[model samples]
Target: MIGVMREGGLLVLTLQRPDKANALSKAMLSDLLAALDDPPQVLILTGEGRVFSAGADLEEAKAGLATDPIWDQLSNRIATLPSLTIAALNGTLAGGAMGMALACDLRLAVPGAKFFYPVMRLGYLPQPADPARLVALIGPARAKLILMAGAKIEAEEALAWGLIDRIVVPEDLLTTARALGADVLAAIPGHASAIKRLIG
Candidate 1:
């Protein structure tokens, strides 16, 4: 499930499935990809409760992986967003969830959130785009440790590795993300758009 709210020029998309750690379902992924097509000038993605995402719901993914194209399309939509996109990692991120976070242009993690890319352990391969993004954020060596060794890194380590842009207390997470979004919004619209295009 995804929750959407527009604040000024930004669109906030909150993953709403705490009991399941916001594991993405095929329909959910379809909706998310559609939302990305005409999103607000900035998009902020976060999750409910104490986890950004636990990745794809394994059972659900196993059932549809061969029949559905949701994952590929959703990944493409996220990677090609023309405007700003921020992943607010409110908590732990695992598996496919790591791919989702990496898709964003920026990331803000709560002080204790953990991150990992565990596709190797799952006997699956990440979408090709993800590896490049991971390498871009943290050099190839660190990316190899995460992908090959299936290592999990906490927020502080993620920040040091350049995987996350900032770390904030749990209670201050949303406030800090909003503040950063507002700061970006403060720029003239055309200039902000130009900068986003150049950086993206």
Candidate 2:
């Protein structure tokens, strides 16, 4: 499920499914789409507990891939969203979950959070849009290393590769993320939007 909260001009969306490692489900994807369509000035995405997301639920992915194009469309929307999108990676992120994090304009991960793209291991190809986004974040070489090897990179490695913007202690994750949001909110709304558009 999605939990939405407003802090000034920022909108914080938390993935609330620790029991399932915050795996993406059809309903959760739907909610995300709706949220992006009407996003706040700055959107902060994080998960409930120890895991940011474990990616698409295998069972759900199997069924949905046959009947829907939610994942593809969601990726497209996320890539083109006008707001300042930030992924507050609280814990481990894998597979399609990595796609979701990559979709964000900025990532602030907990110190020990692990990032992985494991689509190959699951007998599926990475999402078509992922290569470009991953390359944009960390360059072609590192992206290739991640996708080809399905390697899990911890926050420190991710920071060195420019895969994440910041890394903080787990206990400070939310506080740091909120402070970042506050910094964004401090700017005039119109200026913030203009800057986001210019940067994009």
Listed in order, each prediction's TM-score against the native is 0.92, 0.91
Local error of candidate 1 at residue 16 (angstroms): 0.5
Local accuracy of candidate 2 as per-residue lDDT tens digits, 11-76 = 888999999999888889889888776767778889998999988876888886523567767777
Top lDDT prediction, candidate number: 2
Tens-place lDDT per residue, model 1, 1-200, is 88978877788888998999888887777777777767566788888999888888878868765235566667667767666778888899887767667888889999779988787787778766778889988999999989899999988899999999999888888787777777667777666667777765
Candidate 2, pairs of clashing residues: none
lDDT of each: 0.80, 0.81
Superposition error at 144 for model 2 (Å)? 1.5
Identify the runs in model 1 with alpha carbons over 4 angstroms from their true place. Answer: 66-69
Q: What is the lDDT, from 0 to 100, of the residue 164 in candidate 2?
A: 95
Off by over 4 Å in 2: 66-68
Worst 10 residues of 1 by lDDT: 64-73
What TM-score should be assigned to candidate 1?
0.92
